[model samples]
Target: MSNAIDRRDFLKLAGLGGVVFASGLPGFALAAGQDEFYFVQLSDCHWGFEGPPNPDAKGTLKKAITTVNALERQPDFIIFTGDLTHTTDDPAERRRRLSEFTQIASDLKVKTVRFMPGEHDSALDNSAAYREFFGATTYTFDHKGVHFIVVDNVSDAGASMGGEQLEWLAADLRQQKTDSPIVVFAHRPLFALYPQWDWATRDGARAIDLLLPYKNLTVFYGHIHQEHHHMTGHIAHHAAKSLIFPLPVAGSVPKRAPLAWDASEPYKGLGFRGVSVDTQSGQTALSEFTVVKKAQANATDKT
Candidate 1:
């Protein structure tokens, strides 16, 4: 008997593969042939932080903006991973911090900007004030055939996703196809990086399981204030660096506070990440670069 299968036979075989991909193969195939899209990932800006760890936090953020604006190729959008402001229990202070943060954001040349809440900005009353200014705790957006899911993994008082967000995540992943390229973003890492300092998400394993069925899945996060990568099977998790300050490596120190800088080179330790997502190749690349103060940058330009 002939072994060659016809289109009808292929469809019949696909039935056993599951319903998630049965209705999505055509769309996936169409998407696989399209061009890739790129985006910028900036994290832990801490716009209101005013301490020795970063004496020029505001200036560094502006330098980062300049760096992004000077990129050889502009990204399709910008995703600020979180910690938009410093901690403040007072509502007035929180609002003031947010206003200052927005004032800085207004200078951003990129039009489409996505924001998430970190524990610092979400603290005291469950991010009520943050939602009023930034809108929505967790949400999803589709860009160039890929699904981008931004979750609220950090709790109001701690690093956690809580039960409600987990349920929403399960439902959301259930709605996506198996072959779709899924990119998840949040403040705290979904995997346990270092629980001693509250660096990892408490119920992150459940979230990881929810994404297990997808073939091309990547999770981007910021909270540890450094760069790290964790892999669980096909899903890859990346922790982005902070624009304000860098943190000690997990277990490297007794505490997880931001690293103090040398006065001689204050901007040496501050940086942001640029992420390039290639859907056609199913590959993503992240590059980290520190912000140089305009004067320092200008000094280099003259040399």
Candidate 2:
């Protein structure tokens, strides 16, 4: 299957109901509507990472939870895309950070919180600690009429879903009807956004190949720390903004580094995403809500 997004997919985003997604879609307009159900996506929290880029980092995740809770209509569940903790080589420190991160996320009003690993959580010990806190890294579940597939792409550090996981994904998809709406969640973009920075998954091509046969497939991923969308055949991919800090666009600079925070306003570009799926309307609406200075952040801020 070709990786290039078609010109037609951009036209569909206009009718998607207030989704802040960038694609090969040129001259797209925005619109809003009611949804059948909604959920929140929180990514790249980097709980234990300390740095000058963000002064109010300590309250980042907590602030995200508070904002989601204040939503007029609470989401049905929450999914943390990855980077539950900072990169820690210490075994005990890994467990400590994961524990703290889980505790904070556990405070959310919605109980069904699903987690996948980023390089930080899965690289060192092959995600053993993450699995202990969260179940099998790659699995599937059903919500409403949509089939949700969560894949583990970070355990290898090469951003490739190994052969074994790929096979499992194949078998999982075999059970669902070809026309069922499918949503895939992972830490890294399945396509090669930047091979040097590991933004693109090394073995992601095989996975995308497997998914090409499906008519209704969409991917929600993180690690890029910004809003992006693409189309491969009929499959659409959307990358979420981060909870910690924003990163530079793919290949915009020599290095793939997190963008420096605005000195005047902290947490300006950091926020979470809310995605609502309305089976009735056959539409999905995504909104990126920014957290401003850990106070007075509105969830309605589009992108």
Q: Best candidate, lDDT-wise?
A: 2
lDDT tens digits, residue span 1-303, model 2: 332222244235526542435323221122223225667888999989887786667877787787777765567788999988988889899999999998898888988989899999988888898888887899898887788899988988666789899999999999977777778998999988778888888888899999988766778999888888877666778888888888888889998777887755667778777776644332455666765424454232322
- 1-303: candidate 1 lDDT, tens digit per residue: 332223333334434421111221211211122365567788988877887777676577877887777765567899999898888878899889988888887778888988988888886768888898999989999888789999987644766677888898888888887887789998998888888988778888888888888887888899888778788777878887888888899999876677888666756656666655555434565556667543574452321
C-alpha lDDT (0 to 100) for residue 26 of candidate 1: 14
TM-score of each: 0.84, 0.86
Q: lDDT at 292 for candidate 2?
A: 40
- The C-alpha stretches of model 2 lying farther than 4 A from their native spots are 1-35, 280-282, 292-303
Q: What's the CA RMSD for each of the models?
A: 9.8, 7.1
Best by TM-score: 2
Report, for every candidate in turn, its global Cα lDDT versus the true structure: 0.74, 0.76
